[model samples]
Target: MPHLVILYTPNLEAQADMGRLCRSLADTMLAQRDDGGAQVFPTGGTRVLAFAAAHYAVADDSDDHAFVYLNLRMAAGRADAVKKRIGDALTACAKVHFEPLLAQRHVGITLQIDEAPGQVYDGKIGNLHALFAAAR
Candidate 1:
């Protein structure tokens, strides 16, 4: 259960398309599997969400600069190499989404792969995966 959340400054809303970014991230995540295996992430559990920060201050506390932070969170228990590979793939996707704005202004893009506390993280998926495969 990976939740990809994108938080960006409000000023970038005019130039950024959150929906498209989410789609791009989802596609990239789906491409990577454990040891290059074929089992894909369940669509029902894969979440890509975005929130526009109403108030944010970048370096030097200037409003002229903007920032986009991505948090790729998943339940604990994975090899470090596997997690890093996934994180690296996602970072590239984030760069692709923010490059245009970055080229025009002082935009700082950061990405972090966080692991949810396994003890508290609970997840359950219905038959969405089966239905998706049937449609295909």
Candidate 2:
């Protein structure tokens, strides 16, 4: 089944603040789970992951870009809302960790959501090897 990769630009901090933002995003998603079995990426090197917010840094005179990259797994049809929910969670998270930085500019509040389809796979070793060879 295909999953999703969501990337956004939101306000973030310089040092430890990035780590704090990643955790907050995870916490927000986990709070909404009803056994959804979703995973947030890069948070401890899992499939579902979160990178340091500063990893998204883009150069702009406006200082309006702060990037947050997230990857999560879900069944085929769950992409749309999951993307929006991530945005919402990010907005909330930014308010706490990055608000003081962004409040001065006001222009940094925008979120650009980049959503992409992903894949999920499960296999036994020899069967997987056979599948790969067949594809080639």
- TM-score per candidate, in order? 0.85, 0.43
**Predicted model with the maximum lDDT:** 1
In candidate 2, position 8 carries an lDDT of 51
lDDT string, candidate 1, 1-68, tens digits: 78888898888888888889999999898887877585446665688899998777778967788888
Q: Positional deviation of 9 in candidate 1, in angstroms?
A: 0.6
Candidate topping TM-score = 1
Point out the worst 10-residue segment of candidate 2 by lDDT: 40-49
- The per-model lDDT (C-alpha) reads 0.82, 0.48
Model 1 CA deviation exceeding 4 Å by range? 121-130, 133-136
Clashing pairs in 2: 40-48, 40-49, 41-48, 41-49, 41-50, 42-49, 42-50
Please write out the lDDT profile of model 2 over residues 10-126, one tens digit for every residue.
344343255555566566654442237554332222222333343455666555655444455433344566667666775676567666665554423444454334545554243
Model 2 quality (TM-score): 0.43
Error of 2 at 5 (Å): 8.5
Task: Find the 10 residues in a row with the least total lDDT in model 1.
Answer: 36-45
Cα-based lDDT at residue 79, candidate 2: 56
CA lDDT for candidate 2: 0.48
